[model samples]
Target chain A: MKVAVVGAGSIGLLYAIRTQEAGHEVTLFVRREQQIELICNKGIQVEGESMMYDIHVKNIMDISGAFDLIIIATKQTHVKKIVELVKVNEIVAPLLFLQNGMGHIEDIHEIINPTAIGIIEHGARKLSDRTVAHTGVGVTRIAAVTMKQEDLIIYKQMLESSHFPYKLENDWFEVMSDKLIINAVINPLTSIFKVVNGEVVNNPNLFRIAKKLCEEACDALGKASVEYHLDRVKKVAMQTKDNHSSMLEDIKNGRRTEIEGISGYLLKRANDELPYTTFVYEGVQAMQQMDRREYE
Target chain B: MKVAVVGAGSIGLLYAIRTQEAGHEVTLFVRREQQIELICNKGIQVEGESMMYDIHVKNIMDISGAFDLIIIATKQTHVKKIVELVKVNEIVAPLLFLQNGMGHIEDIHEIINPTAIGIIEHGARKLSDRTVAHTGVGVTRIAAVTMKQEDLIIYKQMLESSHFPYKLENDWFEVMSDKLIINAVINPLTSIFKVVNGEVVNNPNLFRIAKKLCEEACDALGKASVEYHLDRVKKVAMQTKDNHSSMLEDIKNGRRTEIEGISGYLLKRANDELPYTTFVYEGVQAMQQMDRREYE
Candidate 1:
């Protein structure tokens, strides 16, 4: 399988390395001149607690090529631009979005063929543009929105052989909903509070806010509610005690956050009567606005 | 008139200088050894927008004579200590509390003769210890819980001669209630948001919170209500748009805030039905606790 890892961020780099280690030809599509140079010069270095690997890398926009799978692992705010870059470059493949937050599926469907699969790839950002540590081996579920079986099966075989946990779910909405719950619960709070994920455990106020926000999102989605979202959210915050959320990463790096696509979105999507959740969302939004003003 | 200004902070220095300029002998009480040495050697320099004056200063515990008016201008947390110092020094006159908030009256009453007057002196903090800009020429209202005619006349004459727009109110409780309303509305919000008194006008959410808190406080006092307390609170926030609240000053200086003395007192004093205000109080307390843990 020929895999093109678009954006070439920590997540993209990790995926490229795993796929290449499984004997698949992996190509890294990166925009920044420095990232391309570094990856090409040093290859992709992925160091986890127990595993380490280096894989092939390249600048996809510069090179002329097509691949079996194209993973969109850039920040959510960069999704539209990456999509435009892909469309303008005329690179066609089954694109996988591994960014945090929800509602990127519609954007992908609009830009490219509806042959994209969204994956909630959870790990840790070891550092900025340097190394990515696979903190925990979590199951990655993938499903075809508008793709056929042959392509799906071929990609599944490659993913399974890569030694990274991967699963297939026809109900990708459920998976996406689950991921949204976790991200909404952890990302904004950890980012806004400027604390590690685990600090939410001792901070009762933060824990309550996280749980309430998650329930709000679940209520907005109108799906079969899972009673365990709160526990799962708490567990994730506790498990990743030392790690900052992706939003916090953006804040630390002085980049735009995906707050609009997460809590901001939930507030707009949720009904007007949900004042408790909406109040929390609005408060988070105000804090985000403050950050934006401070940075600008 | 003989006057002693307790707590040689910016406000204390201002009162001492103005009293001295009005031809009264004024003594500023210092707490710390360094403050005492600094003030005694260099004099308390009251640098305002218009003029600068060096005030004659003395330590509170070092004073050997009584004063006609003792103005306490320390942060609310230091009130009890100042009262104790005043009691030990045997300076028994009308000790007017020049800080905002509603809890100091009881504390001062318990420690001193019931003749201590509660003052609501509002203005601005323009700089550090050396300077204070008088933004508004507001009246320094003094009401004696219990006082002889000689003491009352002396206190009133001292304030009037000092060019301070002051008046004596028969109902001290009403005057204190009005100031409490203002402080309950403005202090926590300005401190928590880290905004100036005026910036709350631009942030409607803050304005709403401030108004709601003030209304809750007014209801708690059960006073002859004025429609303008809300307007006055909003006007003050806008008027001192660039100035930090005393509570914010405490936070910035890493001093323990008067949370328990100000908004905390209002919340504790209000009936159980005003849970919304209680919620705001708890929120402020939570932030204060977090700040203590973070800063300390």
Candidate 2:
């Protein structure tokens, strides 16, 4: 199987390496020419292991070949642009988007490719352009947005290994909301507090705040299964205890956060004002501009 | 007039130094005996001024001599215990408590000494045991919690000078509520985000969070004048632009914060749940216990 990953982020790097290790031909398409050079030179360094894996790399602009599957591993903020790039490149391969929020995913019914959305339970942190640490090893769950669920099984098989498993969810909305609520609860908090993912649940006071975020996400997204979502959030938080949330890493590294897609999306979707979500959305936003004195 | 400030904190040191400079006999009472030795050896250092003022200092445990006025410049958490010490010492001086929130100020009516509560608009940060930088120079407003407002004038005169001035407010509830709402808005955000006071208003994104906090505070405290309070918050934030909030300084210095008095008190006072307040209250509380990974 020849797989093309659309972004050279932590998630993209992880998937590209793992799939390539499973004896599948994997090509990682990065936005920058410099990144391709970096990857081609340094190969892909995985944490806790000495050998850097040599994976194929290409500029996203020069995406020239057909592949078995295309994984959009960019942030939720980049979904529309990536999809537009996909359409222009005339690549009609089955597309799997691994993003945080349900941003632009539901609206992509008009896209050319057979699209699917995935919720990656694993945590990966990119140390550099060509290095990614697979911090937490968990299964990736995929649901077909435009593709049939039966057709997704083969793509899942192509990506899964003995260590990296893949599961299929029946409903795209259900699966995405489950991931969204958890991301909404944990990501902003870990970023704002500079705590690890598990601190959201393990720290009792932090857990109380995380519960409020979960409640707001549940209410605003119109999820009736509150109890189940809350339990799932707790479980994932505990599972990824040591992983610094991507948003937290972004803030720490001075990168633009995907708040607009995550909590900000929930704020726009809700009928009523989600105070807790808004607080965190604004909290993270404020933190971006924080400590730099505007006047004297 | 002989003035004794019961807490040798920033506020206490500022008041003691200023009163002594105003040609009033001033004695600062401190908790730690080491603080007295530090002050006795080094005198008191104020920011922006080089000359060290020789202010008298004594341990809080000994309240032997008589004084014309006693100012309780301790934290809101230490109010009750400080008031008890006043009773135990039997030094019947006109008492004035300078602190944040309405924590135990109203309850001090049972005390024998004529008591007044003051809202110190000036910002001060304790740099060391006996040194405080006067960050903002706003007038202190005194209102009688148990004593008559007419009777507070002489004590105010004793503390006021050309540089340090005090004002008398007819209604303590209104003035204190004004301060409480502002503190509730500014303190937690600055502490959480680690920003100075001005950024709460100067930074537009931060101002949004500040507005939500202010709105929730006004609603929780039953203040119908929303627009007025919001304006006051903005004004105070801009006025203290360069000053780090006391709570922010405390958090940075790894000291205990007074979240319980400000947002915690408002949470208990409100009939309905204050999500914004709870989020920030738990935010500060969680931050206190944060980053200390519990398991693994």
Q: Number of the top candidate by lDDT?
A: 2
Please compute and give the TM-score of the first chain of candidate 1 against the native first chain. 0.86
Give the alpha carbon lDDT tens digit for every residue of A126-197 in model 1.
455647776666666787766775677667777775358677777666777777878777876666555677
What would the DockQ be for model 2?
0.53
Tens-place lDDT per residue, model 1, B1-296, is 77778776667767777777777888777777776666566565444445555666766668657666777878788887777766786666776777777677777767545364556464645355555666666677877666664566566775675347667777777777777777776776666555666655666655555655667787777744546788777776777676677776765566677667666777677674453355445445545546344321
Worst 10 residues of 1 chain B by lDDT: B287-296
Runs off by more than 4 Å, candidate 2: A41-54, A291-296, B41-56, B291-296
The lDDT per prediction is: 0.66, 0.84
lDDT of 1 at B257: 73
- What are the per-residue Cα lDDT tens digits for candidate 2 across A1-296? 88888798888888888888888888888898899998898898788878778888988878766888888888888888877777787888888988888777655776868989888888788788988888778889899988977789888886788899999998999888878898899999998888888888888888888888888899998987778888999898888777778788778777888888889889988998788899889889887766544312
